[model samples]
Target: MNVVSKIEAAAPAAAVEAPAERMRRVVAVAVEHGDAVDREGRFPAETVEALKRERLLSVAIPAEYGGEGLGTAAVADLIAQLAQACGSSAMIYAMHQIKTSSFVMHGTGSEWHRAYMRRIAAEQLLMASATTEAGIGGNLRNSICAIEVEDGRFRLTKEAIVISYGNYADAILATARRAPDAASSDQIMVVIPNDANRTIDRTVVWDTLGMRGTCSDGFHLEAVGNAAQIFPKPFSEIAAQSMLASSHIYWAATWFGIAADAFNRAQAFVKAAARKQTDGTLPPGALRLAEAAAKLQEMKGHLMAAIHRFDAAQVDAARGDDAALSSIGFAAEINALKVAASEKAGEVVRIALLVNGILGYKNGTPFSVGRHLRDTASAPVMISNDRILSNTATLLLMSRFDTSLGG
Candidate 1:
């Protein structure tokens, strides 16, 4: 069965159609434009439009806000399916969901944020994030910009080094120091609606080796909004409780999708080679195909395990056990998932290319894995696997590893 079919079979019936069914058209649109989007380093406008038309963008929002109220696993699956068709579109969607998760999990307390959630659902708005700054050097936990508040309104000016698809976002979630005198680590997350009060000045072009359609250019961002637009919780708490887990899980799913597609192409090439033989002998690449398939399975198992752990943690967190979400073990495991998935994705793609040999090296053939390789190549550096490992190593120093399977 196909990915959509699996989603349909596993999902319980609801009043609205399953998100998987809706994603079918989106995947088709993405596949149609994936090559051009990559070639021109442009946005996947058609694919995003299909998502809006199907109202899939609001799948992560709560039901109270005119959304479907789907859980994390469901959204991750959809992201993986989209990634198989177009990596850039899938990353764009994944990043949007990460930003949406912050609002769904933390923004409902304030009336202003609640209303914004409603708007996000009702209008199918897309969200971008501005956490990486010029001075911080990819450290989201620290910020040089500060939000200036006066007379119940606030203003912020940030030199963001990378805001993925910022020009096309309807709103942006930005991080900044809580006050002018606050420590760089003391931060807040504010919602900046793309209105007349907001301006994005392009500062750097996004010409990269892979995942070209993301348009992750640098910008000078200035925005004004009511103080109420900010979340009640600190950015640190928000990152621990929602953003961190969601980003890693969903991103791993995207990489998995890219790897899965590459494997599929490799399998096709192997099968074709086998068919050409009259003695019923397997192709020389068959053993390599088997090895790649095993690695792919390992990657999927790791992602699914992380998803279940995250869901269980969310349940505990909802029951007032904040420690469940804040535990060092959980954080370390999620970080490991990102590192493993990123590395394994590149490995699987490389194996697939080896299986297909010269054909996989080409760009326009049915067995081509060139785009898949390019796209997966960006996985490790997205958050920098080295940085994640460094953080995980620090976490491990404070906690003991659990050896039991049940644990």
Candidate 2:
């Protein structure tokens, strides 16, 4: 069926206008202003401000802490919807949510952490990740800096490869060696609220092909906080349970949003073409649109399946280094989904571009898909799909799953 037919026969829209309704309104603002944000390489501050007004920044935090207390799947839906309007805004939001969820996941037994969570909920404070280091080569599991302690106070300094929207964040959640004498891989996470002597010092410029509104520039972060600010839990657990897992899920959602936008555009083009013809024939480009739609459906299924699996495992609330998740092969499967979703999202956008032909290549037109095309191009390389596949290759070699019917 064509677009109009689908809508006429469509299932009922929500009676009360669900939270996604608010997100869609935020998306409309993003779609209106996204071009300016991308062209000037400026942060989507206005779009972000609108989302904050909607209290979306705290959408995933627990209710006891004054947030919406939504689940990972729900948060993923929000980000995907946001991406349909503005890729930069969605990604920036995704990173902030991932960091805040990290704060919630592994931070325990510390009164400071509890207070901080309440403060984040109250303030709707945006969070930034200073995880990627200058020399870590994108390995979040390793960090070269160490926290130095004197009396009950601790200090840390790190050369961050990129801190997305660093200037706008109220605080940064960063990783460091567990102690001055700890190994590079033995890391601890601590929050450095934006305060005196604790601002992110920009060391490099940010100019990129797409997702430019993120303002992801290099920075040198230095800060001092009470030793109690440090999470008692290991960084490994935080990364495994919250950072990596949650980020992958949310990232895939936004990617889907971008692709969905492209697919919608393509659908409009095909619908118009059909309307112009008396026979209501399928346009030559209709097949490409079909492929894009199929890929999008596949992407959503793959992502949500893995997400619900994690939820069922209750692994997000599991304590300690979370070595059990890896032992049971959940980590490997999640990584595989990340790889597949990233690659497939890009493909969907590419097919949509093909369906739209030269119009999609143009900028600033109703049918123009340049922004969606550009943003989707960055999907696969954001976390380096090659690295993920390489890691999963080892799992494939040493482990196997039962594929028998009804087994």
Candidate 3:
């Protein structure tokens, strides 16, 4: 069976109601400014503003720290909603959430962290993640960037390839290698002020097939003060569990938004064309459009169900690396959903092209489908499907070996 069919056959029960109105506002802002952002390669300032105004940025912050303290499932729902509207905005938004989560989880008690997070909670400040480097890539275990202890303080410098919202963000959450012998993982997560000797090369621009508004540009690092840095946990421990799980969940949720929006658009297109247009006195390509729409709905259900499972695991069980690894199952499920949605994006665009003909490709048509299609298509590659699958296989093999040895 196809991914959609598998999802339909074993759909998990629903858990919570997503903030539909809030999500709709995000979509409206994205769609409204999408073209301008695309035309000028500008950041989606309005969309980001809408999210901040809605206080959606604080979805993950704990209540004790002046945040809503919602769980992963809710945050995922919001991200998926945002993705459906604008992939670039969603990506930017996703990075912001990652930065925010990193701060809250790691920098909670520090005065600098606490002050920064307070501004974030109040929507007065924005944070972006800058972990993915150019030559070194995003390997958490191995990175050339270093933080050396100097005169009882850490001196840090690192290159970051694409820091989303780099231009507008108040802070950046970065990951680098510690003094080699200092830790087992060699990784360290730190927050840096956006203007901390961080010079933007401005050589790279996000001129891809989709998500044109993310403004995820490349940058060069310079010697900067380490006074603003905070380590929530040791690099090895975060790598072994929390960081990976958090990233996967947030990213997976955002892609679902892209899929969901494509599906909704396809559904509306099909319904309208079915009633208004007919080739040879019958609706042409109506059945294909219907199929695509159905698949999208099925995909949404699967995505939500997978999230529910993860939420349950978090709420009712012992939590640790083992518990966090359980999220990989959800990760796989998300991968399948993304695949389904991405493929469906092409199909829906085709259907839209067929149904609306030249109008679909016209200047102001809402059917400007190229953007999300490109963005979603690029997502799997950026995330490294092969790596995730390989890791899953390794984990499975290790579990089986442990079982056989009666451990």
Candidate achieving the largest TM-score = 1
TM-scores of the candidates are: 0.96, 0.91, 0.79
Clashing pairs in 2: none
> What's the lDDT for all of these models?
0.92, 0.81, 0.63
Over 321-349, each residue of candidate 3 has an lDDT whose tens digit, in order, gives 35543444444544455454445545544
Tell me which of candidates 2 and 3 scores higher on lDDT.
2
lDDT string for model 1 (1-407, tens) is 85344433533442258789889879999999998999999999999988877888889898888788999889999999999999999999999999999988898788998898888876778999999999787899999999999999999999999999999999999999999999999999999989999999999999988899999999999999899998999999999999999999999999999999999999999999998999888878999999999999999999999999999999988888989788999999999999999999999999999999999999889888888999999999998999999999999899999888994
For model 2, residues 38-94, the per-residue Cα lDDT tens digits are: 999999988987776566777777777766678888989899989988899999999
RMSD of 3: 9.3
Those runs of model 3 whose alpha carbons end farther than 4 Å from true positions after fitting are 1-23, 109-112, 180-185, 195-203, 226-228, 277-282, 316-358, 361-363, 400-407
Model 3: lDDT of residue 83:
77
The weakest ten consecutive residues by lDDT in model 3 span 8-17
lDDT of 2 at 143: 90
- What local lDDT score does residue 39 receive in model 3, on the 0 to 100 scale? 68
Model 3 residue 343 CA deviation in Å: 5.5
**Preferred candidate (TM-score higher): 1 or 2:** 1
Identify the superior model by lDDT, candidate 1 or candidate 3.
1
RMSD of each: 4.9, 7.3, 9.3
